[model samples]
Target: MHWRQKVDYWLETLGDEDPLKIDLLKNLSNEKLMEDSFYKDLAFGTGGIRSVMGPGSNRLNVYTVRKSALGLAQYILDQDDDAKTRGVVIAYDSRHLSQEFALEAAKTIGRQGVQVYLFDELRPTPLLSFAVRHLNAYAGIIITASHNPPAYNGIKMYGQDGAQLPPAAVDSMVGYLEQIESELLIEAADEKQLKKSGLLRYIGEKVDLAYIQALRTIQLDKKAQPKDLYIVFTALHGTATKPVKKAFSALGFNDVIFVKEQSFPDGNFSTVKSPNPEDAAAFDMAIQYGKESNSDILLATDPDADRLGVAVKNDLNEYVLLTGNQMGAILIQYMLEQKKLAGNLPEDGCIIKTIVTTELASAIATNYGIKTIDTLTGFKFIAEKINEFKQFNSHTFLFGYEESYGFLIGDFVRDKDAIQAAVFISEAAAYYKNQGKSLYKILTGLFEKFGYYKEETRSIMLEGKNGAEQIERIMTSFRDEPPGTINSIPVIKIEDYFKRESLDTVTGEKAEINLPKSDVLKYKLEDGSSICIRPSGTEPKCKFYFAVKGKTAESANERLSELVKAVFNSTCDLALHSI
Candidate 1:
């Protein structure tokens, strides 16, 4: 059937009582809108489903949410009777319809006779992950879209291990999801009766307290005083306000100011242009708060609170937001320093990072005799390695982080924990302040000790069907005819993750890449610069990652500029005709 037929089927089959009916009726004449809405079933990646919330096959409405829940229920049942008995933990952020969606999933699973433990209120996504492990549940689901704009919302699936579902599991779930014949006709169990049958339970402060206790264990220096380190924090209108506040206060950080305007759980995220901490614009209000309070540092977490963004005072006393790579490098140094001092630095420990993340983190780990492992760009891959380490005893897991602000520590939670990061960052800040030094000085010291390393990212957002096709074209063009040189620097080798092989541009030699296949391409420049390009895993954008190391920061920045222009200019040339 054509895309038009899909839209027509939805229009005809939808009940008059369905809320999506009116929206579909009003947009019928908008051919482009209809096409985009019905062009495909929303792409369900390994991270689970995310898309704009509206009334279409591609939109995330109650019917679509029910479809996903029904599929999950079937997948859970297929595992074993014990799997169904172990149940799923459900939580939601502050997004519009988040609670509604959560309840819908719970009801759907309950109808299938699977146990459900739903959060009593909005909570950070990390808490959802923790609940799965803490309760020994079979699976977990959190209703969130992370840092996306207000118009979007999603559901993320986690496995029994408390990590996002691995690729094979996702593939199975997708198979189950594809077999559903009618999303609208599916019925959910009555919430009241689900409770009476003991199939549904609500979780609250008890779990929160347990998670905080687990967090406290990761505090490297109990004697480190945070009283002198004034800090500013903002949840950016998501779900971190309650727990982060509790963690900070519990740790004795008394002189902290919460950004009042953005602390509320508003789905609109009215205080900023975008909710993402990676975007510097989100820090404007936090910066204002930092300046007024003369704060030493600023911290912001996304809605689900799995990712953290930090800003600190530079030499000029202007607050500067640290990139994910910069913060990761700092944490690596600080964690190792404290571990070595305490004499618990394991001789066989390892640090895990994504392929696109900075090698500076690896350099810092190497200095401590800790091996660094590189995986594809996702926290699940990092979690996979954590599981592997435990199984094989190959190496002790020390830390795991990706370049996109996602981090994991303590292993209490399988995914990123901004709460943990906020605590450890506070400890690091206070530890340095006690020595009469600032975090800025420590960052510079790292650069001085391990050469100047810098990295930058550029992305292009292509929305709707045409935009997605254009992204494929751009990727294919780069893969088929690899760039010989980027900005007058020779392309020494090309790593094609999809092909699972590396080609030496000069020698015409091919070597196998051991990692799983992904649609990613990386180039090694002769001048010690690196360039990687891949489509965003969770968004409709193509991202370019550039990294360069130099004797000084100025040289690194200049070299980075040239490499970025070379890639950006070339990509634009490819998109000009299609776009």
Candidate 2:
């Protein structure tokens, strides 16, 4: 069908119920709106689905949410009988129409006679991960866009193990989702009817208490209480301020300040460019508050509170923001060194990180005599490793993190938990302060010990459908013919994860990489430098990650700078190699 025909079909089917659809139908004579709405279904990547809020096939609304839920219900029902009874747990973050979307999914799944446990109000994404296991639900759904702007929203699906659904499961779910022609004509039972039938339950408080208590158990140094290590925190206008503050107070951190302007659940995220902790702008309010309080540290969480961003006072007493890689490296070093000192370090424990994250974490893990496992991007892969360890009883999960400010210290919640991270960070700060050392000093000490491993990331966003195709082309170009050298450093090895193949440039030998297929490429340099290229799972962008090492921080910075320049210089020339 032509795009216009699809637009008319959408108008005829949904115009009556959705005001946005009605307004859009009225403007159908305009070509741009029709093209925008009917160009295609919103792209569902490995991160489930996210899109602008509108009344079209390409947007997220009541219709799209129901259709997706119905498809998930079909997939789950086909999986097993236990899956049918176990149903799904649903949670939402503080976003426009988030609550409505969560309930819509419940109703759609309920139409299939599947049970649901819905949170009474907004909660963090990690809570939903915990609820899935606590209730033994077959799957879970979290209605949040993470740190996206107000005009956008999303739906993330979790598997039975309380992690984001794996690739195979997502592929199967997408196969069924494609067959959904319209929203399910769901017949929902009232709360009373659902309760009487024992298929629907509302949960709160109990789960919150359990989650908080679990976070408390991972403290590295419980006795190192510092009296005056004043700290400032901000939630970036999302769902974490209250819980994070409570976690700090519970940990006995006496001087904590909240960024009042960005503390509440403001959908606009009015104070910053975006709510992503990866961006320095997200910490503006917290930084200001830190300066006022003479705080030793500053912390900020993204919308759903899964990712944490931190800042600390430097030698000149100026607040210096740390990248996710920097934070993860510091945390790992602190945890391992302290655990060994306390005589509690596990003999058979392991740390986990994504392939594209900084190498400093792996180096730190190696120094602690703990093995590090590298998974593909996304916390689901990290959670999958955690689950694998639990099933076999092979190794204990010490920590899991990504370069995007997502970190998990304990296994209480399968996904990243800033609430947990905040607690550990506070404890670590207190530990160092007790010894008359600042976190800043401790970080420099690690750089000295770890050989100054520095890394950086750059994302190039390509918007809309054409951008998507271009990204595919870009990846294909690199896979077929990778550069022989980067910045005059000979390429020693290349790993093409999509084909599960690794090649030795020097020997012309190839070997199978024992991992699931993913569209990512990594190149190792002769100088112990590396570069990784992968498409962003949640956004319309492709990412390039650069890692370099040197004897000193200044040399590491220069080496990293040369590597980044080489990658950018080859971008256009490399794309031309695609067929």
Candidate 3:
């Protein structure tokens, strides 16, 4: 059917009760708006569906959520009978309609006769992951868009292992989702009936207790004097306040101060432009609180609380935001230092990081005799590695992180856990304070010893259907005619993850890449710098990542600026045309 026909079908079939549908119908003359809204179905990728909330096939609305939930229900039913009994765990973050979406998913699954353990209120993404393991559920669903803006929301699926569903399972779920036609027609079980039938159970404190208990085991130097190390924490109007405070207080960090204005769960995220911790602007309130309290460190977590951001007082006595790479480096160093001091640093222990993350991780791990394993760009791949190593007992998983502010300290929760990270980061700060140092100083020391390493990421937003095709075209152009040099730095090697091959530009030799296939291209420069380009799996943007190593920080910064300018300039024409 044509896009216009789909739009008309939605307009004619939608119930009169939905204001969104009414508004959409009132704008029927806007052909561009209609086409953009009905051009294609919102994609259900490996991370599940994410989109702006509205009344369209491409939007995240009640109908779309119900359709996806029904698809998940069908997938669950296809499994063994025992799987249905095992059921699913549902959690939601502090996003608009997050609670509504969670309930919708539960009811939809219940309609299929599958039991569901739903959180009574909003919870972090990590808690959802933990609930899946604690309850031994067959699967989990989290209603969150992570750090996206107020206009957007999403639903992510998790496997029994408490990690995001792998590619194969996601593909199967997508197959089932495609079979769903007319989201308006998808039937959901009545909520009251689902509850009375014992298929829908509301859970809260019990699961929270279990998850908190599990987090305590990862705290190192819990006895350290946290009183001497004042800390400021902000949830950015998301869901991190409760678990973070509980964990910190449990570890005797009573000097912690919460940014009261941003502590509560607010879907609007009224405090910042974007709730993402990676953005320095998100920490403005926290930094103010930090300075007023004379705090040692300020930490912020994204809405879902799976990613953490840190700001520490630098030499000028002002709070300076640390990049995700810097924080990951500090955490790695701290975890390894404590483990080695306690004589628990296993010879086979390994650190897992995404290929796009800083090479400083590998450099630091080398000094401790700990192996560093590189995975694809998502945390699921790291979780997959943790499962793999556990099954084989070949190596112990020490820690895992990605460049996008996601970190995992232990294997207890099979996802990037900011709750666990908050506790450990606090403990690390206390340990350094007792030694007469700060996290900033420690970070600088690491840079000095490991050689200055800098990494930067740029994302070009391309919205709607035409944008996706342009993104594909850009990738194709780069793959076909790989850049010879980035800022006069020769491209010595090209790693095409999609082709599962590494080509030596110098020798024209090809080698196999053992990781799963992905639409990512990485170029290795002669000067030990690297550049990677790929479209975001969850957003309508093409991202470029650059990493450069230099003899000093200034040189690295200069080189980074040059490379960024050159890469963007090279693609300027294509980007402008696409826009």
lDDT of 3 by residue, 406-462 (tens): 999978799998988888888898899899999999999999999999999999898
| Structure candidate 3, residue pairs in collision | none
For residues 400-483, what per-residue lDDT tens digits would candidate 2 score against the true structure?
A: 999889999988788998888887887788788878888889888888987898889987887666777888998988887788
* All models, RMSD in angstroms: 1.3, 2.1, 1.4
User: Which sections of candidate 2 miss by over 4 Å?
Assistant: 26-33, 184-198, 570-573, 576-579
Please give the range of 10 consecutive residues that has the lowest summed lDDT in model 2.
Answer: 570-579
Candidate 1 residues 210-276, lDDT tens each? 9988988888999877888999999999999999989998888889899999999999999999999
Q: List the residue pairs that clash in candidate 2.
A: none
Prediction-by-prediction clash tally:
0, 0, 0
TM-score of each: 0.98, 0.95, 0.98
Using lDDT as the measure, which candidate wins? Answer: 1
Pairwise TM-score winner, candidates 2 and 3:
3
User: What shift in Å separates residue 377 of candidate 2 from its native position after superposition?
Assistant: 0.4
Better lDDT candidate (1, 3): 1
